[model samples]
Target: MHYVNAKGILSNKNGMNLYRGCTHGCIYCDSRSNVYNMDHAFEDIEIKANATELLKKALKNKKEKVMIGTGSMTDPYIPLEKKIQSVRESLELINKYGHGFTCITKSNLVLRDLDLLKEINEKAKVVIQMTLTTYDEDLCKILEPNVCTTKERVKVLKILNKHDIPTVVWLCPILPFINDTEENINGILDYCIDSNVKGIICFGMGMTLREGNREYFYSKLDKQFPGLKEKYIKTYGNNYGIASPNQKELMKIFYKRTNENKIMNNPDEIFEYLHEFPSKDKTKQTTLF
Candidate 1:
């Protein structure tokens, strides 16, 4: 890991990535695409030395309390987070400023900030977004090797639910001819139902492959599942969005299960929920007036 001074922290939409690059070795990581243009190796995490301070300043100057999001290009709970604690510090700042908070992560390390997340939710809103790719534990290990398995992530969701903290699951990147199956979708949906997740965001039943990430993904595919790389090349060729042949079938299951469980399935609606800041404080102030 290397440190670099960041000029700013939060994005125009109140999102921030305290680090660049990731160590989570997920083969289908789109962040590895050359479109992002990272100068360093994907594993060499670039730490934002001033992220917390910048976040503090940003939160202090905000005219209205809005949701602060992180872990988009990089997961905030990456192992490096345990050492640097930038995400933790940012959470403290968000809570201190009474702003809503949300993040997307694949690691169970998010459990470390349970108290702060609970506090933020009680004050405003705090939503935990986790990505679940493969439901099979062994397959999950293969797919998201560096992070916690599906069962562990489900546990985190359940714990958050127990605390009355809303959670959303990103059910995506279902690699074609690999994990795109009824059993896999059903298993993951079962977990979301059991966890009482507020929503499940699934753009489609497949993952994207591009310049940098495509080569890396094929390499891993060759190493882990021999001959599968050739199959992908033959099927997808130069396509960027590698939709699953079973996309329609799998999506049918996804929509059916999520709708049956009353989990929000519309991407737009879920995003609105994530970005919406609670008006409880405003209501309280109005009452006082």
Candidate 2:
């Protein structure tokens, strides 16, 4: 991995990606795409060495106690997190400043920060999000090689939920003719229901393939599942949005299950829930956990 001082830590939307690249090795990782213009190699993992300090400053100056989100562009609980603890330190800042916090990751290592998460949630809000693409463990290893499998991630969700920490699941990039099936979706929903997740954010029952990610995804398809690349080429061509063949039926099952389960299936509502700062609740504010 290479290190560099990042120009800025947080985006205007209060999202921060401390590392430019990821080692989690998710075959469908949009971060690995070339359009991001990451000059460094994808797996090499670029480190924003100044991220923690910059985050401290950003949090200190903010008057309102709003949410600080991460793990959108890269997973925060990647292997290097244990060594650097940048995400941990940044969380310390957020917790200290009485700001809300949320992170989306596929790694179970997030459990390591349970104490701090509980503290933050006690005072404000802290949401833990995990992405589960496949319910089958073997398929998980191939889809997301470096991170924990779906079962382990679901276990983390259960543990966090047990502690009253709100959880969300990202059921996305459901590959066409691959893991995009009713059984897979049902298995993942079972985990969500068992774990008592507050929300499930899924844009649709499909994946996106652009200039940079399209090439990498096609190459992986060729190597991992022979003859799949040609199928994708014939089906998708140069177009970007790669909707699954089972989109209609899968979506039907998805909405029905989510609504019946009372899980927040609407993306807009979930985003609002994540972004809103509940300053009106003085008892909650006074806790200042």
Candidate 1 per-residue lDDT, tens place, 60-113, comes to 998888888888899999999999999999989999999988999999999999
User: By lDDT, who's the top model here?
Assistant: 1
Using TM-score as the measure, which candidate wins? 1
Predicted structure 1: clash tally: 0
Candidate lDDT values, in order = 0.90, 0.87
Q: Tens digit of lDDT per residue, candidate 2, span 217-285?
A: 888888899999898888989877889999999999999999999999999888777776678654333
TM-score of each: 0.96, 0.95
Instruction: For model 2, give the 10-residue run with minimal summed lDDT.
Output: 280-289
lDDT of 1 at 130: 94
Candidate 2 C-alpha error for residue 209, in Å: 0.8
Scanning candidate 1 in windows of ten residues, the lowest lDDT window is 280-289
| Model 1 score (lDDT) | 0.90
